[model samples]
Target: MPKESSQRGPTADRLHRVVVIVDENSNPFELGCTTEVFGLRRPELGRELYDFRLCSPAPLTSMRDGFFTLTGVAGLEAADSADTLIVPNRPDVEVPRRPAVLDAVRRAHARGARLVGLCSGAFTLAEAGVLDGRRATAHWQWADAFRSRFPAVRLEPDVLFVDDGDILTAAGSSAALDLGLHLVRRDHGAEVANSVSRRLVFAAHRDGGQRQFVERPLPDLPDESLGPVLAWAQERLDAPLTVADLAARAAVSPATLHRRFRAQLGTTPLAWLRGERMALACRLIERGESRMDVVARRSGLGTAANLRLAMRRERGVSPSAYRRRFGPRVA
Candidate 1:
């Protein structure tokens, strides 16, 4: 976590009211994914989570699904009252750089509210100018287009998500879940996030970039040992890997391994392992690996029923649907 916020203030204890701005040509997946992570109540985890409002810029914004429409529910003012604002995916026509919406996002950000853009939601933030020179990400398919359209934004296409402290972003679709879980862990604690992840059955964490797992895999060599560890762990994910088990292969003591990971990866051994396993499940699902039993054993997540339970809560996709379309891409 960042310790450099000089403008320290009182921490509010109210359940975070996260308002998501729904658009006409919005991705119901991304919008719902946002709510799943933030809006849903997690009492078993024992933390104040959020109050979600699926708001639209207008009083009765419309949503399209081939040839149907659903009421947008809340208005932009609802978004204005949000503790955190989410833009799922913009219309297929053109990503809007709405002055009104942009002003709301900026004001919310300035007031210390976290703003998130999932997939093309990045388009909204970039246009609002909040992403100027700041590290951000979008779906791999749109990486080139996003860069061409908004050069001021430093678009990192390979990572699952970018956590620039107050402002955060993720690649399209399911990577949104990764960012959401990251926030949960950041705000609450490892135990809480882990529990939430368990309920969602989503990868509590991921391994290498979505690139390595994508159809067009990236090279393996890098200036880091974590990748090797990640790959090694994936192959033997079924094995109960201890910190010492991982540390020995890395040629470092358990304490040293923990220290190095904290400095570089910002997490501990067990946490990283869980993330890697979850990521593998995501990959398998994308590659038409739908059998929960196979995905669970292969990804080292556990069982088919467990996978179903987890996906329903966190990833917000059925095993069947996940196999159909991958949300996050590591291009």
Candidate 2:
């Protein structure tokens, strides 16, 4: 199947209706990411897009910093009004969502608005019955907790986001960018998403799921060791770059490079490269409307069959299916 961007449906030309639900003690990392993507204006992204509003359960709110912030209670009424709604990292991990907040999420979802749950925010969505029988994801660290709490929802803790039609869930922290860029791709087409990534100076794409295999207790390795080489390799994933090529570029032997990668990133050079390739391939499928053959060639995945195997093994979707679902077209 070809990964063609859908030339159909109501394009996400603007997000004039957007809301972010913030609660007391929200994780700053995830909340900040939401604000950066939707709350802040980027004229460079589009002349007209995203009329972002911060929705709070109460008329007044408090940030993680413990300072009270005055905000209009974009209560259930305001939440139900948006075209899209975001739930950043939850504040009360030990406690379940309050009745009012849960009701607001259900109301918004019922109104046909897209709902996103970042990190443990999925717990709230699950409480609202939004993720019943749907495949969802959360930060790898919380995978066990999530499964215990929401056993009915198929939990995928490795990937960045699980795009289950109107409901989307992402892993921790930086994974928010993966889902945010995905939303851009879905709403405005590949061109718009690519433009936004470029403006933000993010690589136009990154392949693979989130870091479930992350080297826990990551060593405080010297930045001078591997950072520069990573940037160089990322810029050239399409090139015929090999471990030997990276070794040469990084001024190290292949043996040293392999050891360094294992010590720092918890994976071999080739595996990381493969992950990056698949991730880039997914971006191309959604954004460029590129076929599998083209994506395979561009991402250095070797062949269409290899790309198919990798995409399926990683995402459980064929390239065409993924493109169609995440493509600008709804169908």
Off by over 4 Å in 1: 1-13, 64-68, 91-95, 207-331
TM-score of each: 0.62, 0.69
- Runs of candidate 2 with Cα error greater than 4 angstroms are 1-16, 139-143, 158-161, 189-208, 216-224, 227-331
State the C-alpha lDDT per candidate: 0.69, 0.72
lDDT of 1 by residue, 168-240 (tens): 7887667878888877755543355667788889867653243312332246744445667766776898776
- Deviation in angstroms for 202 in model 1? 1.2
lDDT of model number 1: 0.69
Which candidate number maximizes lDDT?
2
Error (Å) of candidate 2 at residue 24 is: 4.1
Q: Alpha-carbon error at 132 in model 2, in Å?
A: 3.1
What are the clash counts of all predictions, listed in order? Answer: 4, 5
